[model samples]
Target chain A: MQGDPEVAVLRLGHRPGRDERITTHVGLTARALGADRVILAGDGANRAETVADITERFGGPFAVDTVESWRSILREWEGEIVHLTMYGLEVQNVEAEIREAHRERREPLLVVVGAEKIPFDVYEAADWNVGVTNQPHSEIASLAVFLDRLFEGRELDREFEDAEKVVVPQAVGKRVVEADDE
Target chain B: MQGDPEVAVLRLGHRPGRDERITTHVGLTARALGADRVILAGDGANRAETVADITERFGGPFAVDTVESWRSILREWEGEIVHLTMYGLEVQNVEAEIREAHRERREPLLVVVGAEKIPFDVYEAADWNVGVTNQPHSEIASLAVFLDRLFEGRELDREFEDAEKVVVPQAVGKRVVEADDE
Candidate 1:
């Protein structure tokens, strides 16, 4: 996990009462974009169960968990923490530097995505506060762009292990194959 | 518009009965990520109005329109078309080639994003049918990645001509400034 800088996503401020779909997408996007795990923070309803369902249905070498203290998590992480925010350094400007550092150190990477009013401490704690664009946009989009750049687009070919369902690429129609389908 | 690829996004297969937020994001993402215009295709209720409202509130050098025939639009487009689908070629693999061709030909880029079951014709008609990743994922995410790569992340610095409200990047708190604000 360390050699290639295995990536883990930390989704902060999940408010299920407001928009569950967005929170769910935070985790789903992480998994789809080649993150090895998703850590859901905040008191979002059924956050763990929801991610569990996704892993169960999609099949995964992925993990999901809920945490109460994102600050502690950030402070304790063994590798660099890349915080996705609009106020930070533009991603393109610093991505290669971060990637090189991670590879050389052979440390895992933790990506932080915020859902609510992010505390300033989080910003200060991040080794690299990266912005996909210096504009307020969806966190999902920022994570997608960041991961794409981080991996140099090789994540597109990532294969999920033990997938209960998988999409087969097609030129015309949509076809999803299940594990039971011989 | 031609030399640098004036980009237009066509959001296909919108249904009023379905999710509207996702459709709205298609337009918002396009504008935020650097598309010059977003063409909403299909009978989704208030699709055009939604995007227009976004432009009005968010500020814009961006435009929004609705069309009945995506095929007709595609057939008559003045430049090359790039259709986003999981079934398409990996974006990273083809993006450089497409950019080189578009620049050499001075052709604009029309990016097609689907909201429902896309017809086979789109796959065949596209100059480059591209995938951010060959996985069933959100359309908004795909559009972001595509635009980011197309512009080589320079889109991150694009400034809107007349933004009514804009977020001032902050290290801590959220602060949005209005055009008339002191």
Candidate 2:
């Protein structure tokens, strides 16, 4: 992710109590899937903390923050905007152009992932409105697949620095060793 | 998906009220991303109904069902079993083999998605314990990416039949039309 353009995921319209876990998953997925950071655009301070805790333990070049105004983030964003929605053009159709802009052209990417309903203006503001599949499902999943495609699966092999613990991938049981980097 | 192995997702150890939406998203992701069905291995009747309702509206050959004992379902399962976990073998390393057994050998696939902590036996029972990434993330995201990889990205091109409504892919606007197939 170092050489890749800065990728930030903006989680819009989080309903505090109802979306607590879902929003938390959104942040974690973004971090694990190669996004440099995530901006929570609602009252998701606690969710931000959960992700921050994971980052603290698991390691991070990842950042998580809470923002009061999502619209301004959109208006002031300096790079390419991609809105992930069920109604958008298929990701497979638009991934190449996007990857070119972000990876080849080195344009920063702001990916907008929404909750239940999104405002139309967000769609209009995006350079590409992309869908992992034009069907009903989880936004966390949408972001995961979209990022995977954007990185062309290289993110899976990524090793995090400054970690306190690292998973030792096993065939049959759990195994996590303390980070020797410390 | 028609000719592929019968893929079913088994969600284990669901804590009713707290895991409601996360479980629902699991079921929906399973359906939308090419799984033939999702077997909710807990008290997920309401969650099953929610998925069923979406299936009814969106069209499906997809099925959602609740089981009293998850162990029984796993014990009686007819084909290969895959448990998704962060501590498991990296998916990129094992996906081809898993795909071969399911796609070429025509063995059914039962993908186990866990809630909080999965029992050690689940790992032992699985033919392959796979991780989408050796990093912490959402199970819904793991399932979506795993299925996408297993299907080699063809699932996004899938068309659901008997749908009452279908999304017309857009670049910057929302559009849904009644399925004329009805």
Candidate 3:
């Protein structure tokens, strides 16, 4: 919430034992799709570390952290809140409005993605509850689609500044290019 | 390739031991994003059955099959070929043109998604080698982004007619609506 007006992600409802891989994917999707940072708000302390490790390995101008209470965080955010849910207005219907507001207000945009049964308070607190698709699917897919639209597809070209291992594009074979120090 | 002029997917380079989950996701992404059918090309005979089972359970107007030879299939394809790859032209740049061409020709689209190291011949055979992003990412993510863009996000609203279990959109809690017969 303290960063520049660039978009960030708030992932709530992570259940540690049940959501390890899914939670890590949420963070990965957020970073890969142009979020400047992610706040994992829930009881998944180990999940937060796993996500942080991914960021560290993949390289970052991105940050990751964990918080205990999403209710207080959502209530206190200074910027517009866009909660991703299946029941909300379609993303295409409201993305332009959200983008316009973000530009005019010049405040950080917090895009919320939930992992478990999100409490009713979140829907009430969000400025916009948007759905990438109404159908049931992976939250990772929803975040990917939402961020792609929010950034207008420009994020596809974004490059990580410090990746230790990078894929080298090939016409015939597989090769991962790693840092010389490795 | 024998289907209507609507979209179809060809998933190539399936490595059975390594690409089980990735290949399954490719099928899921294809079905979810509005492709009418997907042909699992190359090795991994069992992968075809896994994908077929998913479609059977999730409900589909979608079709799934497997083939041993992608080279022959690509050569004989009756429609335009659009291969998904990281080294190719960006999807946003070429998607409009591809869509326009498909419309004008009334040709079925064969969208190729690879699971392992794709051979060079694929690049040459494809009518358009489209990149969802230049970065190395999951094939599932790439397929999702590509199909969403191809259909101009309309696919987001599509509903499966026979899904045994469907997610009910909720603002506050999770509920999966199940078919009474099941």
Quote the TM-score that chain A achieves in each candidate. 0.92, 0.97, 0.89
Clashes of each: 0, 0, 0
- Residue A11 lDDT, candidate 1, scale 0-100: 87
How well does candidate 3 score on lDDT at residue B52?
A: 73
List model 2 lDDT by residue over A65-159, tens digit each.
Answer: 88988999999999999999999999999999999999888999999999888988999999999988889999999999999999989999888
User: Candidate 2, after superposition: displacement of residue A158 in Å?
Assistant: 1.0
Q: With candidate 2 superimposed using the best TM-score fit, by how many Å does residue A100's alpha carbon deviate from the native?
A: 0.5
TM-scores for all candidates? 0.82, 0.98, 0.73
lDDT string, candidate 3, A122-174, tens digits: 88888888877665445667777887887778687777777876655444334
Off by over 4 Å in 2: none
> Which digits, one per residue and each the tens of the lDDT, describe model 1 over residues B1-182?
21266789988888664546567767877887888888887674366787777678777778888887778989999988889987777786888887786667767889998854788888888888787766656777888888888887767778765667776655444467786782
Ranking by lDDT: 2, 1, 3
Better of 1 and 2 by lDDT: 2
Q: After superposition, how far is residue B112 of candidate 3 from its true place, in Å?
A: 2.7
lDDT of each: 0.77, 0.91, 0.73
Ranking by TM-score: 2, 1, 3
Q: What 10-residue stretch in candidate 2 chain B is worst by lDDT?
A: B41-50
